[model samples]
Each structure stands twice: as C-alpha cells, then as structure tokens.
Target: MLDYLKKSFARKKARRQFQEYSHTVSKFILKEEGEIAFANWNNPLVTPKVISQEEVNFFKKFIPKGALCIDIGTNIGDTTVPMALAAGKTGTTIGFDPNPHVYKILEENVKLNRDKTNIAPFPYAITKDEGEFYYHSSEASFGNGGISNEIVSDQGAFQLPQKITGINLEKFLEKNYRALLPKLSFIKVDVEGADKEVIGSIGNLLTKYKPVLVAECFTRATSEERAELYNIVADLDYTLYYFSDFDENAEIIKLEGPKDMNRWKTFNFYAIANAE
Candidate 1:
C-alpha cells in the first residue's frame, strides 16, 4: 500500500510539471509570428532559444525559390515552414519526423501554412535499412528523442520506449519519390545522434541528385564516427561549411579540415555537392 501511494504521488507530480511546461510553451508560441503548433509541451523547439534567426536566414539563402527540399527532422515545422515558403508554389518541401507524439503537431503546422507553404509531413524514421526500431521518447525535450539502435541514454526526460518504422531512404525515394529525386535541391537533416546513419541511408541520392545537405553534427559523436561522416560527403565530392554561431552576418566558414569545426554540443553545417 505504501509503494502504491509513492507511485501515485510521483504520477501527480509529473502531471503538474507537464502542465506548467505546457503553459510556458503556449506563452512562447503566442509571441511567434507564424501559426506554429506543438504536440509536446516540453518540446525544446517551442522556445526561441532552439531556433535561431541566423539559421533561418542561412536556410533561406541556400534553399532557392521553387526548389524541392527535404527536412529530415522537421521538429514541428520550424525550419520546414521556412523551407516551404522559400520553395514557393512551384516547389515542394517534404518533412519527416518519426516521433508519433510530435508528428501530429508537424502535420498541424503544415496545415496551418498550407496556403503559403507546400510542405508534406511524413511520420517515419529514416534509416539505412527498412525495418522496425525502438525510438526512445524523451520526456524532457523533443530534440533528444532518438533511435534505439545506439544506446542513447542521455535522451532528455527518458520517457517510455516506442516502436517506430524505419524507412530505407534509397528504396523509399526510388519507389515513391523517384520522379522528384532529380529535382531535389536541399536536404536538412537534424536526426539527433543518428546523423551518420541518416546520411549513409541517402548515399545514393546524395550522389545522384547532389542536393545541398544541412546536417547537425553532435559533439558526442566519436572522432572516428565524425571522420566516417566527413568521408561519406567528401567521397561524393562535397564541400563543407560550418555555422559556429547564430550570427546572421557571420560568414559561413569553409571547412578545409575536420579540425576547422567548432566542437559545440550540437552544430549545424552544410555540405554542397558541387561548389566553385
């Protein structure tokens, strides 16, 4: 009876915490310009700290008007919306988020901007192979949710585990998006620590379409893992550029070597297939 009471108390506390977080998120959203909705109240992206204005400007500069783009980790349409708007009516933007909990919000955000942004949201995790995988749902922050393939214990909030479908990027593209492959212009990938796997899965497409890739490189990744990821893009003859901070006027430094990158906990960088 005592144990039961303890569990009940814990549950109540958690509920209260969640409620407070939700209210804070709502307040934050009210200040934003766009009609952005979030399924998870604790989603880090809901806070302005997560989305930087410079990052938005960088994406806008690269993702041309009327271009087909892919947002690997849409995260409630923060970057996806801008990509869609930049793509314009003649272009298409496909956003993917495996987290079912947050996917609903992604869909809602896309719908909210339907008239202005041509963005499609898919709730499937992209992987090197097509199969089932456990996705660690983070109770603390939406940004921390990641695949179970690698032991990601640091997933914030550490919520219940969920089984998510992993789609093979190459196969999915060939089967359904083959016609749109050649038209692919940009791909923004921010799949937590699964950056290598995500990039590897789309190796063929990277070579064929040569779309500009914007990937998040987590400092937690081992030097070897980073090297392999760098080689993957380098082998395909892509030039690397790094965005060390959120300064809009900051120059996108050309990464000549691995040592060039500022080892921030998580940093966004770009890889252009063909560069002068």
Candidate 2:
C-alpha cells in the first residue's frame, strides 16, 4: 500500500493521464469504502473544479451539518459526497443526474465512499416534466456544464436517449417539505442551459425553503429569456451573489431594473437567500 501510494504520487502528468487509467483511479477510491469520495477530470462525467475559499467557508457557515442537501447535476458525486460528509450520518443527500455514463460513475463513487446508506442516487434528469431530450457527449468541449447546445449531434456531441424526470419542484416540496425537509440547506443547480426550466419548476420551494441557491446563468441566452428568469427569482426576493469560480469570495450583484434587458457572454452564478 505504501509503495503504491508513493508510485501514484511520484509521477505527475497532464490531467488527461488519469483518464487512461480511470479504472485504476476507481480502484483507489473503492479500496477504502466509507471514506469521503473525491474525483477529478479523469472521471469524465464529473470533474472537480477549484472553488473559492470564501465559498467553502460560506457553505460552512450556512449549510448546517446534518442537513439535507440536494445536488442537481451530481455528475460524479463531487458535491454530493461532500454534502454527505457535511451532513454526517444523520443527514441525507439526494443526487440527480441523467447522463448514464455519469450516473454509473456516480453510483460507483457513492459506493466507494460508503455513502449509499446516507445518499440516495437518482438516475434521471430533473426537468419541468417528463419528456425526451438530447444531450451532447464531447471530450473536447469545455464549460456550459448542462445541455448547452441544441439536440442536434455534431462534433462528437452525440444525442443519446434521455428522459426528463418531470419533477414539479413545487409539488415535490408540497409533498416532502415536512416529511423530508432537512433544514433545507444548500442547493446547487448547474444543468447546462436548462436553468430557467429547473428554477421555474421549483418556484414555491425557493420561497419556502429559502436555501442558499448556487445557480449558473447562461449569459448567451436571449435577452428576453434571461429577463424572464431574472424576474422569476426577483419575485422570490433573493439577494444575488456572483461566483465566477468556487474559490473566489462571493460578491453581491444588483439585478437590472425590470426594464433593463441586455445579453452578455459571461455566465454568472447567484447565491440568493433571505436578507437576514
């Protein structure tokens, strides 16, 4: 074991090198079950990105330990696993992902971390309703983590069979708000370009739970479409916080007036919650 660890850490290479030996990486994490599961770009389905120190601390402050956390784009359980750890044995984590390739690896990581008991894995995409959609599979395309491009497959972005788990977030809240609500802590949404739909579905919960929302906004979206989304959240009365990357400190950003409608290429994340 000592020798293996030494060898694995001795030679450092490009991030993609781990992709060649994904199985090996899987084995390493799987060897110790119940330990915190962590993954990187090698996983392909979910790649770990550097989050800002302030953001980490923010979660520490607001995301209570042993609170139920929901991960929308679980990918490979990067945030899901940590959420489980943060919640501890008493807490529960629910992860949702539609990509079969990513879901398989997410389950593997869940087992690798021995979080199967604490985390419930859902293999489906969270959309406004149940319906068919297309996804892109690209090894080269970076960013726009969710379904950014059109359903059309090109440049190796194949349109695989996908079904949206028509989840009326409001209804889910009405059903589980009392029975399963866990302090209703942190919520992360990075579903490519479907942010509008996902948020729309959770209209009531956003108001009831009032959890800190980490949402990714597609800057390239049409001016009108962006305005609609901004208005939806505005009506909810959430203070917007911007996070370009996880590691930087979150800054308060004012939303444009109801009439200001302009399109930008920068994707901004808003950390919205009650003022007090």
* Reference-based TM-score, model 2: 0.70
Q: Give Cα distance to truth, residue 94, candidate 2, Å.
A: 1.2
lDDT of each: 0.69, 0.58
lDDT of each residue in 39-126, candidate 2, tens digit only:
4434333344432334334455555667777888887665676556556566667788876656765777666545333777886667
Q: Model 1: what TM-score?
A: 0.78
Write down the worst ten-residue block by lDDT for model 2: 23-32
- Give me the runs in candidate 1 sitting further than 4 Å from their true place: 1-57, 137-143, 149-161, 245-248, 262-265
Give the worst 10-residue stretch by lDDT in candidate 1. Answer: 23-32
lDDT, model 1, position 39: 35
lDDT of 1 at 206: 88
Candidate No. with top TM-score: 1
